[model samples]
Target: MLQLVDFIARNRFFLVFVLLEIFSGWLIVRSNSYWGATYFNTSNYYVAKTLAFSNSAREYTRLGEINSDLANENARLNALVATLSQKNAKDAPVGYVPDSAFNARFTYKVAKVVDNETNRTNNYITIDKGSADGIEPDMGVISATGVVGKVRFCSKNYSIVTSILHPQFMVSSKLIRSNEIGTAKWPGKDPNFVDMVDVSRYTKVYKGDSAVTSNVNAVFPPGIMVGKVKSVTVHPDQTFYNIVLELATDFRNLSYVYVVKNRQLGEQETLKQRLGDRR
Candidate 1:
């Protein structure tokens, strides 16, 4: 306390000058209309800037939560679309469109893709969801753009997805223009393209044909977009055309995915199991 008093005593003249300067500035601003306006305008500008910076920082920290809410909302929309489509499918023109996909009842779950591999030979995706979240093996995973993959395995809090780029990965897809069914497979070199094999040369495939999932099994709902036919090639001896598809889902930008749960899948599997046992 003695030292503080001595130090203040020594700087008394400077301290008084600083206080007088502050008081003079305040008096000028208060007495002069122009100065008061300018002072308040400047202070308000800085105050607004400060508030904006602080608000931006707060919002930046909540990005993860915002993304999660968006994912959940997307899931709800997907489920709602599935339900509504099934009810309205019968009104469509007969034979022009397949109604099986729309008929399927699906439950949607939002999942964040924690890890994704595109360059690897057997590319797999890891997601931040698992059995604990009602995710399980064989559940189809899809992005907002298109089909992603199916769940391969799951732990209590995480799951691995079999990427469409995997060599063994195949989704039954049909060219929309020609309605030709083919197996969409990745041959393990380029991640951007998938091969649509088993399509008969006479199927009348063409460039720009959109390929979508077909009603093969309960894995994926029919009509989910797979890709577009980039090229269609045929060799002299080949029975099937080498149809190249530009994948709709960009694996490099994969961040969030929706897991599809078919409400009727369990019943279908149970029936198949009983039939197999009888055989």
Candidate 2:
């Protein structure tokens, strides 16, 4: 307290000057319209800028949560659409009601990608869902834009996906325009592209043609986008075109994904096993 008194005594003159300056500025602002307007405008500008910066910061922190919500919403909508489309099919069983007759073949479970890798020869992604959440090893994984991978392994609360970027990962795909079937495989090189092999050269494929999951696949439902063809070239020694595709899902930017649970997969597998035994 004594030291503060001594310091104030020493700076008394300077403190008085500062106080007077502040008073004078306040008077000018209060008495003069121009100064008052300038003061208010300056304060408003700073306040608005501060608020905007704060809001942006808050939003940045919530990006993951926001993405997860959107993914789940999309999953719900997609599942509903699939159900309705099937129900309205002309070949749907007689006496089919949209509610009772509709079988939920595929349902999506939203999950956050806890880990992702795209720079390796065989990349994989880990999600924060597992058997407890109905995630299974063979379930298909997809992003909002398109296919990501398939669940390779799972625990009670987490799962690892063999990313579509993996060399060993293959998806049965077909050209959207020509309906020519092919196999989508990563060439063990570029992270931005996948190769659609076994597409015959005679197929009506073009540079910008799209490849999508075939309806016949048990994992992904029909028409899930795989990629757009970046290049299509005829190799000299092969009857198939060397086609490259720009992957629909950007693995580097992936935050949320949906695991496709095909409810009939087990039934299909069991039937297939029985048929194989007969053969």
Best by TM-score: 2
**Clash pairs detected, candidate 1:** none
lDDT of 2 by residue, 128-194 (tens): 9999988889999998888999999999999999999999999999897887999999999989999
Compute the lDDT for candidate 1.
0.89
lDDT of 2: 0.89
Q: What is residue 69's positional error in candidate 2, in angstroms?
A: 2.4
Off by over 4 Å in 1: 1-7, 90-104, 203-206, 273-279
- lDDT values of the candidates? 0.89, 0.89
**Tens-place lDDT digits, model 1, residues 109-144:** 999899999999999999999999999899999998
- TM per model? 0.84, 0.86
Error of 2 at 149 (Å): 1.2
For every candidate structure, what is the RMSD over all alpha carbons to the true structure, in angstroms?
A: 3.4, 3.1
